[model samples]
Target: MDRSKRRFVQALGATAAMASLSVSALAARRTTWDLLIVGAGTAGLPAAIFAAGRGRHVLLVDAAPQIGGTMHLSSGQMSAAGTRLQRSQGIIDTPQEHFDDLMRISRGTIDQTIARLAVGEAAETFDWLMSVGFEPLAGHPVSGLAHEPYSKPRYYWGARGARSILEALGPLVDRGVAAGRIDLLLEHRVVELTTSRRGAVTGVAAQDAGGARRELRARNVLLTAGGYASNAAMFEKLSGIPKFVDHSYAYSQGQGLELGESVGGYVRGAEKYLANFGVILASEAQPAPLLARADFYPERRPPWEIYVNAHGRRFIREDMQSVDAREQSLRLQPLMRHWVVFDQSVAERAPPLIVDWEKEDMLAAFDSGAAYFYKADSIDALAGAAGLPPRELAATIEAYNYGVQTGNDFLGRRHLPVPLAKPPFYAIRHQGVSITSTAGLAVDGELRVIRRDGAPVDNLYAAGEILGSGATQGQAFCGGMMVTPAITFGRLLGQRL
Candidate 1:
């Protein structure tokens, strides 16, 4: 075996018995697979493991250099009711409760079919992960941390985030490969879906990274290859939002959606473009850029300052609890740009606003003369330096200060801890950037790909963000929606077939 393969095998603790499976050195057998799944990722890996365990010959193909497609990028945050972990902690939750919580958190914007399926199948998927040594971070399973909160503490993942899921799942896949129940192929991109004369999906056409072509036949095909977030053109076309700062996986090229569309499958849930507002990119790279997102969530740190648009108006109350309200409010502004304006008084009194950044670090960034950060002795100068209308910005600070003294904010903001009367003010620009696919192709609750008229495309199935997060995540990011649903649908569809 190669050096890296030996190391990987040793890390998995497989010993000599499962060394071959641990190292993916065997050529994929040229045989008809009982199940052919594109993308060995959050959804595809779970699907392959379950199907292979059921005595089916599974073929799992990925275009990346190794297994674990987007899991490398995912936070692995998942939510499920009735998990044994929840029971151990005396937490009471059910699929119906989960469904209701999701609907409520999304404000009833999520697709019911997809939501129901995910809520129903989620607990088993989560339990499976835990049974295999997948663990939530210490003192977790909270109501919510990243997005909106659920009614109960049903949200979780690992300390290493999504890698925890991969660490536990990888060896199982390796064992399947070693036992010959599954064929593993990395660096093989599925280029097209092969269909029968009657329009049933029978196989796939793939191209290796070196440009070699091969056709593989299968009884059924599953597309869990993820969304078009990494594709600038497709991301804009489908989402109607600029692919501003992409921090998603590079292999997320929307190939699955293209292949599905080639077979007459239509897209759905494109109207649900939700921006996750917090990115402060260090560079101007279009598709993929290094980003440091601010910890602006109300739960993490109450706003000691106000967020303003390019027009120099406060979008939402500084201490608003609803994360959806804050995000949508930002989405309406120009380029979804927001600038935090705070006075020296507020900065001195309040806890550090940016996560892990102390009061001194905040001053250091401003002193370094970064283009995105600006400071001035007065609001007028601060506006000019930060590219806003001096009059409007000056007026905004005046009204905010008036509210602080008068005990009544014109903007209805309840938390006016300190105002902008002090000199040497601060303002930092932030972009509302996202990496998740908000829209995607249409699919039934059973995960069958469907045409525009709702007719199921024969012998084809899909899961994960390839089905668009809109179908499950809704107009907002419900905590644990993305990863949970992807794994849920993967486990559900695999067993059904």
Candidate 2:
């Protein structure tokens, strides 16, 4: 391995070793605990910490070998109004304003009850995270980055991303384990939810890596087991789309959703599914690994190329400022995919198309015969190579050049730097995919997993991605909506239950 990779592996090993010191063996001391958290992740960690802090005997179980869940891969972006940090920075805000901004950005698709509950307690969550040594980036609390901007400067993230948040929570969990309040089980997956004859959830039946099964009892069971983005079958079944990308936590196999549904709970928000604008895939395989991301955000890099759909039609203005508008437009394209088409002059002069990639590296992709990069001496040949209609692509390029000459662009695009008239045309395939599950278990305002009749399943609650991205952010990619709500709800449930 290279030096950097070897160092990373060594650091990861050391971290796991230290974390293992805080974990209790798989032996449960009590037959019935006060609470059982089904995932020791972003939501489960806080839930276990606070629940144990309340002197509740808590059993924390996870399918993964360690804790922190999706936070391990998350950007760790968080948004909360009326935070002490915002006040200290002299920026005024409120949860009501946060709610309004979310509704505006999501176009009223979010669950109002859940959204309110999340925003209402988000400040406390952020403040607590800050008090525990979670540091935000310098000059943070900006309006936004890749998502729709909030009205106030409420967005923040740590310099080290989610690991910063995990570092803050790890010590508290160790204290809980040391005090004999929290019992943690790693490499144990909850296979079934044990229920009373009355249909109230009593506990969970978990299986270890060795397939040894054990039934533990608890008065309350909370599912913070994350989403199904990693499970292709479940992703298609729930979101009604092929899982086009393999970019989620491996343990996020929708087991929590299944466990919730098996015990009389229902799932919803399938219609609210939305994929990201687009990403370059490493291969042509279904659910391919992400190769690199193009700088589609016009603010960051004004487009010098035109984006065309499968039919070789320009779907939207390439220079559109709103990221949400771009994402929604991409959602309507064929298979949620598009191609960035440009000519030799634009390719040489435009800023690097791929984020953090050198222009020469991008040119090398075409020479190496990469799956998504296409290059040809003519537009017709390029279209054939990129799987676009030759005649339509030629016509589209002709019209685009005409617009450039006359300055009367049909799509009202303002950043038309050059025409696609130069030879050796190029196209890069971009696929729209989501890294988080959109459909989630049905839950009431109290976060209790509810039936189709809207009644809560007794002793069963859900938080985090198990509640679905749609539940909190609606049909839009609201910044920090998933992570913040997951942490906030986990905290609230931990304190209350």
Candidate 3:
């Protein structure tokens, strides 16, 4: 679907939307709103609902036509200790434990005050989600999946992933709209946060689809607009890392960070540059989002083929139990890149290595002569074709085959079911990819946008990735930290602000 027309407009209730601005509302559009919530996604929607239900006239605007922002693509996994879901599952956990695990995952390089705030409030948000008909995936509330595992069963999402959370939120938003509390400005982009002469945020200046600009006023403005993922320039500038893969939602263009920074907001946590390893780049000559990726999670699927760096030496144990350890080990490799080198025997014998992919399809990729995937008759040829050192590649295979015969693997690899013995060989090159940047607008416990001096910008609040994952998940993808902190912060702001 064309994103321009995709879910662009919120279905109108009896109450008029922003485009249809009633005469009375228009006359006061520049001054009447009590709260202006920008970017109606996970955090934005909740802030709108909770604040509007409290008798505050709200203006909810999003650049995209639809309501759910990243929900369309988000895996939507979430976690909160001591929730009703955990109680029902007979899982014992606490916010303190969650906080400790999160800090351990980030190695204490996170915003402790903000982490405390989110984890303590997350259980209430989870209970509220359940009360609103948000059902969990069967046998969910499990420890973990793609990322690191929690100590107890506290992770879950609906069958539809982010759509499940969106479903639970739709009714609450509709109720607010029906009661004339929320005036949703779908397809309207908030370009700037309008502020006062003394540097206090007063409202937002937005532009609509037809290129018309409007300065709408509100007593309180939520800086929940967009993250930096979709904007390459800002992403590189703030993240200090080139976008190796373009997998973020297109709407996450960092408009919120831009607007906030245009004022007094500054970014932080850039030192936490962590990479998600094993992304098969779309182009071997030049880095791109994908061809596809090898899930390569030892917890889910043990390795059949070995992983080797550009030097053609094994870099990992291939069966590391901890996801964090694997990611850290990957960081030490050349540009965090490696190739999956295997022979015909492993290709036909071992289970498929990539998720949601078949062996033939992978072979087809190799046959296509894509630079990222290669098919060769010899180890030296495979190395030359896949950009690895020829001698090193051949020696690496010999060492591995020797280990396979002696039953004493060099790299502590127990999953050596197949060695590189067959004549026809294959190599799949992969570079690390990051979905979200670890750097973003730094804010305090109140969710107020802050400056470099640790001073808060009044009435200017931010949630979601706008705060950066480093603040929430730290350098590691702590289980469910993104969605959970986003909701918890937005909820906290709506209730107390």
Which predicted model would earn the best lDDT?
A: 2
Q: What stretches of model 1 exceed 4 Å from their correct place?
A: 1-28, 288-290
Q: Across residues 130-214, which tens digit of lDDT does each residue of candidate 1 receive? A: 8887989987788876777788999998988888888888877776765678776666789999998988999898887568777
Predicted structure with the largest TM-score when compared to the true one: 2
Model 1: which residue pairs collide? none
lDDT of each: 0.81, 0.89, 0.80
The superposed Cα distance between candidate 3 and the true structure at residue 392, in angstroms, equals 1.9
Question: Candidate 2 or 3, higher lDDT?
Answer: 2
Q: Write one digit per residue (lDDT tens) for candidate 3, span 1-497.
A: 13232222332221224444432355464455888888888888888889887888888887875677787778899999999778877888899999998888888877898889889989999999889888989987888867877777788888988888888887787777667787777667888888899999988888877787888888888877657777777767765666777778888988888788888998888778788877887764333656687868876788878889989998888877888878888877877889988999988888787778897888887887766888889988888888899999998899898777877889887767767889799989888767776788888778889889989887888998888888888888887888888888778778776
* RMSD (CA, Å), each prediction: 3.1, 3.9, 3.5
Tens digits of lDDT, candidate 2, 122-239: 9999999999989999998999967988989999999988888988887787777667788776677999999999999999999876787888899999999999999999999887
In model 2, where is the ten-residue run with the lowest total lDDT? 5-14
Stretches of candidate 2 exceeding 4 Å from the true structure: 1-28
Task: Give the per-residue Cα lDDT of candidate 3 at 414.
Answer: 76
Residue 312 displacement in candidate 3 (angstroms): 2.2
Q: Once model 2 is optimally superposed onto the true structure by TM-score, how far is the C-alpha of residue 23 displaced, in angstroms?
A: 9.9
Residue 252 deviation, candidate 1, in Å? 1.0
